[model samples]
Target: MSSAWGNQVERWRAGINAWVTSETDTTATIRVEAVWQSVAWGYNVSNGVSAFCDCDGSDTPYVGTGGVYASKGETRTISMYTRDFTVPKTGNDRDVRCGAGVRLAGGYHDGTSRAYCSVRISHRTWYQPRRPASFAAKRSSDTSQSLTWAGDYTGLDGGYPWSGVYVDRGRDGATPSNLATLGWAATNYSDNSTEAGHRYDYRLYSYGPGGTSQATDTLTLYTTPIACALLEAYKPTATTVGLRATGAPAYVDSWEFQASTDGGATWADAAFDEDWVCADPPKGTVRFRVRALKSSGGSSPVTLHGAWAESNDVATLCAPLAPNVSAPGVVATGTAVTVTWQDNHPDGTAQSAAQVEVTAANGTVTTADVKGAATSWTRAASQQASAGTIRFRVRTKGDHADWGEWSSYAVVRVAVAPRAAITSPAASQVLDALPLAVAWEVTDATGVSQQSLSIADASGAVVWSATPGKGVRSLSVGTEAGFTNKSSYTLTYSMRAGSGLTLTKTVAFSTDWAQPVTPTVTPTVGDGYTLEILIEAAQTEPAAVSFDVVRVNPDGSKTTLVSGLKGGQTAYDSLPPLNVAYSYEIHAYAASGAVLNYVMPYLLDSDGHEVLSFGSAAQEHLALRYDAQGSESGKASGETFHFALGTGQDPLPAFYADGDIDVTGSHSYVIADADEYRAARRKLRAHADGWFRDAWGNVAVVAYSYQISYDAKQYMQWQLQLDVTETMWEEPNRG
Candidate 1:
């Protein structure tokens, strides 16, 4: 069996078949089968069968350990021991080709022999698709998560065709399971089954026909909670604003809000209160936005803002302006009062109701309401009590807001009362005439409805009564019997007000109807134009009486000649003006200084004269002149007419025959004193050539003469004689 100089040389052929069974990224496994065919059997020793491969395109020893030996023509086939060989990089083909052959070394050797059979068996290696990298996830919706990764890497799948990708999902750190399979073209996936406000884990694998690859790193993400949308913003009160929103997922624990006053140009954080209310906002238009929050202080992103809502005018929610009372400050007891207020609602809201509260000094309280835009309320007269201070306040309500604050209190004083009093004819007064002047005064603030006057005797018997007109403060009422002389009487005045209040007053008075008796008065001129006045025969009625004499001067001024003089003791002397006529007033008074009677007398001065003339001779005679009368009471005497001069002169009987002396003149006078008598005599001498007219037939006065006579008790008297002639025949007309 040995050849080669000292070795055995045997002819043998080995058939071998080799194929790959498994492979990895670094190594490959192969299986081989061979049979030994001995050409000649000689010196058969232990020659074994082995395999060889061109792992790197070169003939090299096959990596194997065991070998087999067989007899010539035995026809034995032994399986090669399992062996692994390192594989090289397979580029885009994902395949490594190797040249392989089997040999029976140590027992047979033939370099050029065609062995029994040499076969080429193909070996295939395992291939895997690329695994994705850079995995990421984000919220796609309120209930879903979105996933993404880089494209599949080349040179790693061993030239395998990509089929699809596998997406796995898990919740709260749990192990992930296959959630979906997507084609290789899909770079993103949506986890639609995710719940709102939940944490999820996600991974992805790029797979081909080879198999699925390793998963991406587990990703943890949270689905967005339902978004909070702002519904409205409005003022709930004057100082507070409210924000209303809708939408909240099960995981949402709270809400956040922001407000803007400049139409969303800027925003301020608003306090998150229950019902989304904010306090003490600016008084004007405002805008609001809201978002949901989690218990961990995580909230929706600021970029995801809700709709802005505009608030109502802040004034609209304010209480109505303070009310005002328009009632009078001072009122009568039963006067009605009306209260009013202004509807100063900033939004001009319609008035819906009003309330009024009233407190009286007597501790009485009253409240009332008016509905339907009524701003005023009236308290009836029946509700007003007399003699107290009344305080009242009011409040108003609008249709859109709550009732306003109460107004400041208004005070009213009710103190007026009906009053009646006798003004004239005072207490213990004495009246002197019938229809005694009885005057009274009455007053009532509410207004007088009725008034009356009455007079009664001392026994309270009503004797006279009269109804007085409205606004009549005084009335005169008394009959002759009611006002009896020296009688005591009572006067009563009664008044009633519109509110049924009445009052009466009584006064006591007496009547003194009897007056002092009238007195006789005589006045005479004394020496030097002095006046003398005497009063007598007076006052038989009144037990006590006095007389007063007043000299009325020409200038209308009075000089008291005598005041408070007894009836028989009234004699007065006064110097009189020479030519001015004056008068005197005499009054009779009772004991109480009341004027019982008065008289005014006109007195003549010395210059006062009468004219008597005969023919063309006219003379201004003294006041002693009068018509001739046969019966003289010693006041005046007669005057005769002569055709010639006085006794010292010669009578002209031949010139003035009996028929020539047809008329005679006679005149008389009483001189108050010697000065008067002298004055009269001087006047007669001044007109000594006077001719006078007589009451008899035609008489002519050629000369006149006067004589004075003095009386012991009466004034002096004077007589004058004149001769006068009648031009007309008055005797025939008289007959």
Candidate 2:
């Protein structure tokens, strides 16, 4: 049995308890006990012994001493007599206790061995139970009352359910106590019940294995409402009485009307009405205010006041009367009078029914209703039968009460007849020619009715007269034929009054007349080819004078050449022997007027030219004073001529013997021949000294002439010389 035990022991570790027993030595029973420490695991033991041995049936090994031996000890090594064993555990419990009070029974025999063993063992458990962590709560917003909680038991592998968060209302006390059983979701709490003027309190809680925590410091909160709107005012009338407030919501219940007369200082309550009647008031100037009463009992004052206005009760008066006499008086001749007044009113309709009154002199009173549309009045002519001073007064009717006082009196006078007098050509003696104008002045007690005036010449012939209508009278007059020359004349005037009266006046005047004298001329010769004469006549009757040209030679031969001459002046021409001496004469006839006669003669050379000729000549039977100067003489010889440039005598020679000698200068000389001198004189009949030019330049000749020579040769030579010297030298200095 021990041998068989040894073979089974080879399959396990040596330190393990192994046992074997033999019932017949061919079959065996083996037993072993293994032990390990509390912290070790995975034990195994094995023995190197084969259960199939070669001996069979007849072979028997020797048994050990003492029937069966066993050995057990701690081993550092495993041997063939011991076996190793295994247990399925890991980590710190891998070691196993073996053979400490352990018991085993097993056997292996070759027909004779047995073995038994005992072991004791113990092991420690390697796990502990987990505990929960501290409780914590997470709060989102205090005002929102939202919170969450987390701990060690949360999301555990194998533990109890997690705790929930809790919140308290604090001073607000609005938290729901039932909320502890339910988790604190954000929507779970509602504390928003406090008013806008106040504040509230709040707290947060977390529940774990322990009870709920205390509430946090009180957190307070508050709320408020929304905003309001505006209002306006208006005025509709000119009187400023009907003022209104508007611009309000439709639900407004009532309105309050207030007024301010003195620029909004003290306001008076006008009215409070739901119908808005206070908006439309009476007349006058005023300011207004209003308040709106809303249906919700809310009231707002007027934000604006309407503009000011006026009323329609005041009236205006008429303007003062302009200063003038409208109606002087109502009276006949030598009678008493009455008067009226006038003015302009501003209001045309209000003055339509106005009235006026008047008072006269002698304390007498008279009243006349204003007739038609006229504003002035006057007494009737029958009422003013006697002439004198009169007074007046005025007033208006209807709503106007004032009456105008009495006015100052006006004075006037009357007479029986108008006064008459002459108004033109005054009352005195004075000379007047034909066509004399006559006039008169006529004024009367009534007025001038018929005014008349007349004029007559010295022969008592009525020349002109006039009877004018109402004012002055005038007419023109003329002298009568056969009246004496230079005699006095008379004019008379008359006037009749309008109220049946008469007056007459007369005045005298004188006039004169003198006739004009007739004139005659003489013939003369000059340096030109022919001899001619010009005669000018002065006559009161110029139509009556007659003129003729008669040629009288130096031999006393006479011939009547030109006749039937008319006009105030006449000229005659005749042929004379050229460059030879000749004498000529001119005769004039007045027929019915006074006559004047002048005779002149001249000397001509062989060229049929006069030797001497006067510039201008007038014959006088009497001697006259002479004033002379500057190279002037009365004689001429050969080529040298004596004459004056400016009243001075000197001899000047001719440039040529003869051929139309041109003379021009300022000089005065006389011709000895009466007829020739007079003919030369007539050339300047009306004009005084002036400029004369003849194809040369200009010469000045004085107006008067005297005659001295009659022989044609001597006169011709003298004229030629005079023309060359005086007329030539005195010519204008034309450089």
Candidate 3:
């Protein structure tokens, strides 16, 4: 078990960390982790999780309950106590500790998960029993008296029953006797040493290993001269019940009557006579008793001796009231309806059968017998009232022989079947959230009791539902969050009229949210240098979305190149150059400012060719941004830039084609800079800036355009002289 289940065993070890006080002293609460192995679980089977304690450790278990197993991965902490662990016949104080004990946690294979550990009771804790009850001594014979009693409780012993009862007794005028011990099961004992005229009392106690409990009721027992009593009561008149008693010691004369109206706690002397008349007998059940009283008329110390006989029980027999039929308050005909009513009796305590009498619109009365006191009854579809007025009344038969009177008639009206329509979310309606409202024209003399509106998915699963209140023609659903967009739903509104007929109308719709088309940013012009950022989509349904255009500059700052265009507008020359490789971003946002989609517009560059563009670092444009501080008049823009090749081949002294073919300057055009003019010039290949005309002999200007700003912002200052070609050298007066 250790090698195969090392991780699980370690987890169990960590969970069953140490013994805890169950927050209580006597019982030990062992904490065990809820993890278990499921290898023994059969195919498509799961195991129940529980913890058991084998106090005897003999493969026998005790009772326990564990937490619910939601799934395999989740677990809960289980605290097993001595009660959850102990087996029968195990001594709690001694057997709570483990030598032959084990804790079994069953969330594994066939519930065989187990951990062996010792549980020691720190010290002998005491469990005291409650005070004993019903300690009484009754006369058994002329020479003996018997005692009977009950002790307080058990269940703390863990595995064994509480045993041994302590009894103490004393004579009426003497000191108490020594304590007498009786076995746990012995509830009665006979003291055979009692004399006929003496009185004695007994006190009871329960003793355990801890200590004896406090005294229970100490009742006095005696043998009176009159050993037997018989009391007879009879109703003499409508309101009078007289009681008579016969007792032993027959020679006593002049009997005085004593009566106890309250079941013989205290007696009233002659306040009630054998034939006293009462205006009203008590309504419910009452108890009465009669005590035999005797008095001597002689003057030699008159005495009265009397004793009470066991009481008699009686009740006034009255029939139950009518049963109220409470449901289908607005019944709809032509359908089966279950009639329900509140229990006329408390908690369904009706003692007799009930009957429901139904009078149909045709004046035909039918009485239905209800077997027991079920308050509600169902009328089959065949029994539903077809037209006119039908009424119902109910009666109940109680514990007595006779049945009660019928209840007052509950008038029910029957009318035509209900008609309804789903007015809102009309047919084929497309909406983000499915809001439903239903209208009904159910013209019943009696109004509708319940009406509901629900939206069901295409699979007929109810997605939303609601019950409308009274006088409401329309009911709506769909105020909850998180709606499924790309699906169809059926909105059904149903109204049940007064005659139990339900009318329904359904409307089917689709909530398919067509995603916005991906707009393109393209280079529109046929130049190799510039790109046009355009945004558009192929929309089937017209949507309102504001366009946002952003240009990412070289240093990772964003410029709002263009924005707030609903559609169909263009900004010319707003884009930067192609060689700078800027990234243009376009987004379509709804009125809520929630972005619908990012627009990666097609890049249509100057060459009339679609090009893939990139940001500044890699310079993969086919697009660019010319937004940095510099002379902005296309100052650095040119057809081709030139730099000298190989020191210009000794400066081409005579300019012969064959003499310095290698000295011809190399030409390329890619000087896109973000710096000022002078700093920008330092970045170019080493060369002189004065330009000669091309071989075509057109005098091209290489003049500089200047830019100045207060701090860093630069604007163009354009100036050029197209006639100049090169520096003139002074020819020693030969010009």
Candidate 4:
């Protein structure tokens, strides 16, 4: 049957039966059920199975099946060879079969009829769970931890399975000494491990569907505490102290202060206890130290030794000391007191205090403190004993030491007593007028402190007094009748005790006083036609006088010519005045130098004109004859001219001429012959009228045509004839 089936499968394979399905006890089978039968040959089963499934004979499997079959479904049990399923297996066909079975059953099948199939499958993915990130820590007394995390799960199968994170501290991979766990979905966490040091480690992990991933690289952390120390200290002396401290690692919130006077064995709270420190501590001295304390309980202290000193302790000793005194010296009136001393420090040190002692001649002694090195002591008046000698001296001292030796002695002399006396205007004399002069003298037993003189008139009134320092004194008695007409006055003189002595005296005196008088003068005419006068008397005593002149005119006019004359008399001259008659009045003087009376007026002129008179005189004949000779004949012979004249006067001649004739002869006769002649006359009868006169009023000797020629040379021969006579002449009227 196998041979026959094989022949038929081969025929079927060559014919149409190529697809088939079958089941068996240990394998499922598939075959081509239809065959191509020919009429020449009966139907033949051929092409035995094109595709087949094989179970490893676990349960149902088909040994053989042929021809066509209807819808046969198969269930089978197969044993998979683990060796055949191994990756990278040897033997290609066997490996292909194993891989194809797994793929076909697992629902990854391609539409192909094949006896074997094979495939390769793998996965590349990341397993990162939510873990902590940005870990940080803060400084705390207690141990603590803080952290944050990020989450990412991609390219992972079955999504991200349950995941978590944990923190542990350890150097090695041993069990974690300290561990902290965080569940999945947790991105941040904080843990207080109460740990602090320079070295600490932490670990982070990731978990997914596959397994837990390797832990991340370990991280280390460190922490430190705050520090503080001293920064500065100031100590001027054992008692004065100051301190300052600095906070290290951080800032300080406050400060503490304490002080100790007995070394460090005991301490007391300082007056300046405060938190905030200033640059300058309070003034004055005290032991002090300070500690800077931070908010973190950190502190630093600065203790200063020998910090303060007393305020009044002298830094340098160079000031001067007070002065001292030596033995006292004797004192007397007008005696110099000598004081001698030395400075405590001989190098001319300035003294703060000094003093001296004085012993008087009267056995009295006293002490006087000197403000500075130099001092003075004066003698008392009582020390001048019985007009003898007195002496004194001085002493001195200074800051560093006392001075030796007293100053040289000084002495003064006492004088005899004095007595008061009056000197002038004689006492108890006659009556007088005002302004009387009084004088006096004063004396005492000892030196006088003061002296004076007082004058009282008859009316019992004190007129004046000579006080001290004014050596001479005088008084103006009042003009009242009782005082001015006083019969006598009393003068008192006194002296005061200057060196312990005094004296007083009184005396009588009188006055012959008189007042000044007015002055007068006599009028006179002086040189230069001036109307002047001389002062004859003064109207006041001692003849202090002046004079003035006034010209008096006939028409009641007056003018001042001179004034301000001295010497009790004056001479004035050349007084200017209008034309008038004037007179003089003479003044008389009394014994008191006053003007007593004036003389009666003496008239100088009555009509105010100066007059003159001529005496006896007679007239005479004067003749002139014209003698022509040679070519000229006589024109007239012995011409006679007559005129009335007076003594010392000559008669002027008158002559007639028919034609021009030289009058040189005529002028000569008039000049030589006329004595009282007022003037000469010349008459001429000519065809042309002409006349002329000469310097002496004589007619010119030449007469030209229609004019007279009186040339000086032609008149040089003029003479006049005088007649002796006398006549009364009156003064000419002033025009």
Q: Highest lDDT: which candidate?
A: 1
The 10-residue segment with the lowest total lDDT in model 4:
611-620
Candidate 1 has its poorest 10 consecutive residues by lDDT at: 1-10
lDDT of 4 by residue, 79-146 (tens): 21111112222211121111111111111121222222223222222334433344433223326545
Give the per-residue lDDT digits (tens) of candidate 2, residues 495-611: 656544456777776544333344545445533333456566655552335655555654576555566555445453323433334444444444432222334555433221121
**Can you give the TM-score per candidate against the true fold?**
0.30, 0.22, 0.30, 0.21
Considering TM-score, where higher is better, how would the candidates rank from best to worst? 1, 3, 2, 4
For model 3 the TM-score comes to 0.30
Show the lowest summed lDDT stretch of 10 residues, model 3. Answer: 628-637
Q: Give lDDT tens digits, candidate 1, residues 140-200.
A: 6646666777767574445555677899877756788889988877888777887655557
Write model 3 residue lDDT over 1-735, tens digit each, in one string. Answer: 111121233223212222433524434444322223322222222234344433334454433444332234434333433333422223444423232122335433232344444444443355666555676665555476677766555654642235678778777546556457887677777777765434566778877765677777666555433422765655554344555556633434334444445555655554454353223344334445543333322112234444545436444345655666664555555766565554343112244687888887788999988887567777787766575667888877655566776788877665566656556677988765334444555555557878877778878888777777857776545434123556787877777666666677788776645444555445465332334555654453435366767666545566565667655555333334333334656665444222444534232233321122222221222221232211112122123434365654554333213321111222222224434333333422232333222221122223222222232333342111112122332111110
Better of 3 and 4 by lDDT: 3
Candidate 1 overall lDDT versus native: 0.58
Off by over 4 Å in 2: 1-325, 329-340, 344-363, 383-387, 398-735
